[model samples]
Target chain A: MKITFPHMGNLYIAIEALLSELKFDLIIPPPSSKRTLTLGTKYSPETICLPLKLGVGNFLEGIELGADTGLMVGGRGPCRLGYYAALQQEILYDLGKEIEFIVLDHPKEDFVRFKSQIIPLIKAGGVKALAKGLALAWEKLVAVEKLERTAHYVRPREARPKAATQVLNRALQKLRHTNTVGGIRKLCRQECDHLRDLIDRNAQEPLKVGVVGEIYTILEPFANLDLEERLGYLGVEVLRTVSLVQWLKNNLILSSLGLYSNRWLRINARGYLHASVGGHGLESVARTVALAGQGYDGIIHILPFTCMPEIVAQCILPNVSVDYQIPVLSLVVDEHTGETGFQTRLEAFVDLLSRRGQGGLQHDSACISWS
Target chain B: MTAPVYLGVDVGSVSTNLVLLDAHSLEVADKVYVRTQGQPIRTLQRAMAKIARKNQWQIVGVGTTGSARQLAGVILGADVVKNEITAHAVAALHVEKGVQTIIEIGGQDSKMIILRDGVVSDFAMNTVCAAGTGSFLDQQAARLGIPIQDFGRIALRSRHPVRIAGRCTVFAESDMIHKQQLGHSLADILAGLCDAMVRNYLTNVGKGKEIRPKIVFQGGVAANQGMRRAFEAALNAEVIVPRHFDVMGAIGAALLASETICREGATRFHGFEITESVYQNHSWECQDCSNQCEIVDIVKDGRIIASWGSRCGKTDSSSEYGMLGAGN
Candidate 1:
């Protein structure tokens, strides 16, 4: 069966490796672009978040490319994401597009149904191929994550503008082509070294900004309008507070083993926000506190327009900003976000942080009033 | 002696302002403000011509700010190109050394800047909405059959102001019409509109921020005494409007240009001759990729002096032009 799934940064590279290794015919949708956004918005319900709309666009592109089945993940949460697959299916069916959907949810919820859905996909290669595919996918995932971290480090410190991004892009292209585990490992090391070598150690200390927000907006460059790259270009070192590996480790391995709760996050989020408000609301608050404690120069909170959980987090973020004494700029983006305005806000925020760093505004304890 | 002057130009959606600051005394040598009238390049040229005719000063540095800053910077050869927020904050601090807050309502945007110890502590700009800004007020004034300059005076005559919706411009307009149909006096309705705009600005742009003493109100809208009175009444605090409130962004640009020239020791000012030059601008869709970015080119004397609006950075050649083209 020909399978297709939505893109989430480099997650596609790992998924392509796994599915191809499993001997299943796969059709990867084109990278998210204006056309994808237009198609998604045209078909999607008026108030659904950006991720779901993009997913529908991916499915449409995949279908046009002759893919007959769509693959997605399901979750149980207060977030609207849990209902996206069902809604997308209805949307596709109404559009007269026929495709089988395989939504992989937590196995504990329905082990029998999960096994039934998994058996057919693995029928060709059996459990051995499944294990091998999983191993290869896992290695590639870790490799991309490492490459991303190195890119973040080298971007601000690089002697030349866009040098680190160029290396990272070339490395990502190589990783997408290379299938062998050894090839991926060697590429990860060589490219990371190349990235590090581009840095000018004598460069002035760059401002450190932590990016905390919804997972989709944080991981998907198209979704956040390449925010990390923009910050890096502005001479700020970006520290991402969310990643695919961390999320999977927490939700899949830890939760399945009944050891899911993050003590650090729980402790950090106390007094400000108690209990999971669903999605990444709690995680956003906790990470902001953690980043502040780590002495980040500033924080940028991004969320897709009309995102419920993120809206909740956005409301409470001002309090956190005041309490932590860290400047936080919350940007809500959608298809309508103008690049010029977005750039202006980013540049202003950077200027603010740099001035704060220079102690240009002498700190007066008596006159300081955030409220 | 031709005294050195730093030039600042603010090219906004509704207006273009130019300020010349004397290098020795750091005082405003001259200022020119003109309506943009949907043509920024021409508006900039006219304002520059006015300034050029007034003085034969040596421009040592040039800065540009506002919505069309990059365009103005390219055409004028600016030493520093800054955003409106920084430009406004810099201007406010210069006007009032101990200013704690600044309320700026411009043509298409409004901003609230909170300063602590003379440094910008926090700021908020209206996002994805243009309610209660200068353009909206201007439109309402025209609809009321009164010159925009008289709106503030009429508003001041009202003893009892009516209430209008300020959440959105459409709602505000409809509510104003409804209030007018209810036989309310024109002065009361105008006063109510000012109050609504102030309420909207405070709720949206000034949300959650501390409004303290030494508040400086500036921008094109700051000229409207109605808005000034509304802000004062709402906050229960006196608002200080600088003498050159309308051209604050331009003044700040000049200040920033001076700072950059002091550090860099070189000027990129193309001179006032550009004001008399012939310039042409046009946009075309690039067919290189599916993105199909609409790239705009500013042609001076048959040579493309500046090109921008391309997402892929392929058509961006703003730095290539060192001087006006041979056509000039």
Candidate 2:
């Protein structure tokens, strides 16, 4: 079967590999653009969320390019994403695209059930093949998570980022070409050594900034204007709350175990001073408090154009900034964003943090809003 | 001795738009729109060449917006690359001069901008659905075997409108087909579709809070008269479609470039010759830690200008001037 998947940030590479390993020809959606949005908007219902709309466009584009099967992520929660696969199937059927849908639901309650559900999709159905696919997927996720965590530590330090980057790229290249678990482990260890050495030596300090926001934009750099690296190059250390590891822990470990308190508890300890379901509200406030407690310079919250969860967080962020006596900048990106205006704000914010002595503790209760 | 001009291009999935404006007056000199058809570079190049041929315009400042803004910005040598909300609001402010509450919908997406004074106070975007958008109308017209161009005119003639399940596109489609199969008049069905589009738009895109007047409707879909009438009925007020309704995004982008050009005397816009250049991309894997970063390189004519795609600085390191390029 010609299997296809939507472009959700940087999921294409790993997904392509996994599907190809299973002997299925992978059809990737065209890059997400206005055309994808147009296709998605043309066929999808108006009430679905933006992410789903984007996903629809991706799938539709893939079908138009001759895809026969759709691989989708299914979830279980208050967040509407849990039921998106089913929702998208109905939407696509209405659009007149006949395709088999494989929804990978949360393995929280039953791995056996989840495995059984997916067993039919595999041509060579057995525990051995399942084990291989699961192991490869886990390896990919672990590889990506380790890199993201190491990035946060090394982003601010490396004097010439290109040097550290060269080492990382070489390692990733080797990993992508390898198939065995032992090969992945060997490659990872070698890369880790190089990255650790780069961090320990030839590192500089400008400012350390923690980033907290929605899951997609936080982990997916393309959606956020490469904000983390941009800050890193501006000599800022980036501490991101969302990573592949954290996502795995949430969906696979904590969520399945019903241990959801870590998120809320972490936020409360950070003094978010509010409760929010999603859109990184509690996380943003908590990250700010955590950064403040650690004496970091500032926090930048990145959100989508029309996200309800982020808007709630954006509204409450002012209080957190005031209470913690830290400078907070919220950047909301849509289809239309000015390059110059955005750059100017970044420069100004960095300058303000650099002059933390401008008001110091006396600047307590001051709210900073920049456009 | 002559003032410079800035070219701004706003390319969306539904339409491709271009605008040319004077550096000093910020007056819009020219504006045009065309269906995007998935190839932004071709669409933009065609738009630029058209504007240039018409006015004999000099190459100056350039700005890009919409989803392909970055690609356009890099290809066209844009001095400024911005998002659609900022570009739209900037353009709206220019036209209305402190107008508040702008309702902008295109073929694929719709947005509600609540402007307080001249600044954008609150805004929401419809990235998820098709109910309140142009695509919904397009689908209905196709099902009714009527050209979309004439779909709106017939809608305006309807005395009684049917009910469409505007909650979702699938439900809405089935409802429309059932209405047709039941021998409902074309006019009523058309009107029903319009009402559904309007209702879905307001509930989904315009979901919360007060929707004040000074409502401006613009976009490719804004050309639909039925949609306009539906909005009027839904809001219980008149809906204003600007003179340049279809090309507002381009106009806004042009206005932004004009502002920038006024501040900076000369423009850095690379001439139209950049069209034929072959843009190439190659990927490599970074072996740094457990995270093997996949690095992508952007090359034009075998000369690499930029590279990115790793979570960290794995391949494309940060370039000077805050612009990212191949690992320095």
Candidate 3:
């Protein structure tokens, strides 16, 4: 059975590595674009989250390419994201495009069901395939984490415009062509080193801004309009938000081992937030608080326009801002948001940060000054 | 020696406003408010012509803000290209003393900017729906065969305004028609429309926002006394409207430009002669990738000055035109 999954930033990269090891024919849908969103919206419920609409579009595109089976990840929560899989299946079936919709949820709780679902792909490779496939995907995921971190560091200080972003993109593209773990690590290191060398050492230190938001919107360039890189271009260092690797570790690996909750989310977030509001609401608050504690100059909290979880977090964020006195800009984006307005807000936010970082406004000396 | 002045231009989807500020006094010397009519370059020309006719104002710095900022900035060689948020905030602070909240309702969009100690704290804008903005008011005014200018005065006469739902324009329009069929008084119906718009604005644009007192209202819709009253009645707070209420965005842009110019050495303003130049806009499909974006190129004097509408950032206007440097 050929496998297909919706793209969320670089998740497809690691997923492709695992599926390749399992020796399954796969249809990797084309990258998410305006066209993809148009098709997705055309078939989706009007008020559904952006990721759902885009996910449905990916499947439709995959179906057009002759792929029958769909793979999606789910969560148990107050957020609407938890119910997308079932809703998507219903939506697809109503459109007369019936196919196997395999949903993997709560990895530790449903390991048997998860293994059973993907058994067809594993059996296609060989007896020793499962272990090798997991390792391959894991190696790539780790390399990507390193790569994304290095890119965030190097982007603002790069001697040439887009140098860091270009190298990161090239490195990811190179990793896709290779098959081995060593190859992946070597390419990532090489690209990171090359980007490090291109950093303008003479250039002054950059303003540090922490990007905290919903996972998909924070990571996906299309959804957030390439926010991290845009900040980098404005000469601000972006502390990239959560990666899928971290998510996997927290939800799948740690929870599967019977851990009650993520330590950081439970401990660091306790004073600020009461409970896990689901869909990263508590996590967003926790991360923002942590970033503020770490002496970051600014925090940008982004989420889908209609995201209820983030809205709850957004209301409480002012208290965090009042206590810490570190500026936080909360941006709510939908498909209908205009680029000019989005870019303007970013520019204005950066200006605010820079102004705050200067003229004796910051008494703590903890804030990073814009050079 | 000619006295230096700052030029600010706010180019929106519906209108273009130009403000000239004296450098020392920080007072507006000349102002031009004109309908854009889907032709920003030409509309700008008319505004510039009017400003230029007054005197030879030595522009030390120029700033552009609004939806068409980049386009207008590229054409005029503005020193600072600011967003509507910053510009609006700066302008509100200039006129209103200790403004805690700012309500800006323009033609197509409505926005709420919250400020504390002269720094913008939070902001929210509603552009997706059209029930609460000025265009909706304009449409209802046209349908009622009443001049938009008289809408506010007539609405204030009603003792008891009927309640009308104003979530979306489609629903609001049908509801208004239904109210008309019920033989409701025209003034009452007008008052209801104002009430509904205020309700829609508070829910849609002002959601999750802390709307504190010392509220400053601006933008074209601020011209309506009915809206001002609606806001005051709803909030139980007096909304302060500035002297240059309709052109605050432009004034803010000018103020920001003046500040930037004093700090920076040189200005990038292309000068009044840009008013004479004819700019042509054209669009073509970029088939370089699967996402075929329709790129719009603005041509000036047989040369393509700028190109946009591509998500991938393939078309570089800086290298092609080299106009951004020529001004400096």
Best by TM-score: 1
Query: Taking chain A of candidate 2, what TM-score results?
Result: 0.81
Expressed as tens digits, the lDDT of each residue in B2-36 for candidate 3 is 66788999999999999888877878887888999
Model 3: how far residue A16 lies from native, Å: 1.5
lDDT of each: 0.85, 0.69, 0.81
What candidate 2 gets wrong by more than 4 Å, as runs, is: A1-371, B1-3, B263-265, B275-302, B305-328
Measured against the native two-chain assembly using Cα atoms, what DockQ does each of the candidate structures obtain, in the order listed?
A: 0.32, 0.05, 0.26
Choose 2 or 3, whichever is better by TM-score: 3
Q: What is the TM-score of each predicted model, taking all chains together?
A: 0.93, 0.57, 0.91
Tell how far residue B118 is off in model 2, in angstroms: 2.4
- Model 1 lDDT tens row, B1-328: 6778989899988889999998866689888889899999989988888877767788999988888887888889988888888888888887778899999989888999888887788899998689989999999999999999999999999999999999999999999999999999999999999999999999998988989989999998998998899999999999999999999999888988888787678898888889978889989999875446667898987889888665445566737332111000
Which digits, one per residue and each the tens of the lDDT, describe model 1 over residues A1-371?
89998888889988988888889899999888878889999999988899999999999999999999999887678888877888888899999999889888777666676777788878867888888888888888999999999889887788866678768877988998888889889999999999999999898888999999998989988888888877886788999888788888887778778888777777998988887877898889999998999999999999998888888888888999999999999998888746767877887888888888888654333221111
Residue-by-residue lDDT tens digits, candidate 2, A1-371: 78888776555656755765676777887667556767676776665555777788889888988999898887654457777788888988887889888888767655776787677757553556656866776786677557656755675676565455566656666767778777777777767767777764645465778787777666545456567766765567777766665666775677778875555546464444445555455666676777777887788887766666777677677677767766677777654323333543454455446545333222222211111
Ranking by lDDT: 1, 3, 2
The numbered model that scores best in DockQ is: 1
Model 3, range A1-371, lDDT digits (tens) per residue? 77788888887888898888888888998887877788889998887788888888888888888888888876677999877988888888989987788787776656777788666666788767767878888988888888888888887788866667767877887877777878877888888898798799898798999988788899888888778877886778988767788778877787788774767676767777888888889888888888899989999998987888898888888788778878888887677535666777787787777766665233223211111
Q: How far is candidate 1 from the true structure (C-alpha RMSD, Å)?
A: 4.2
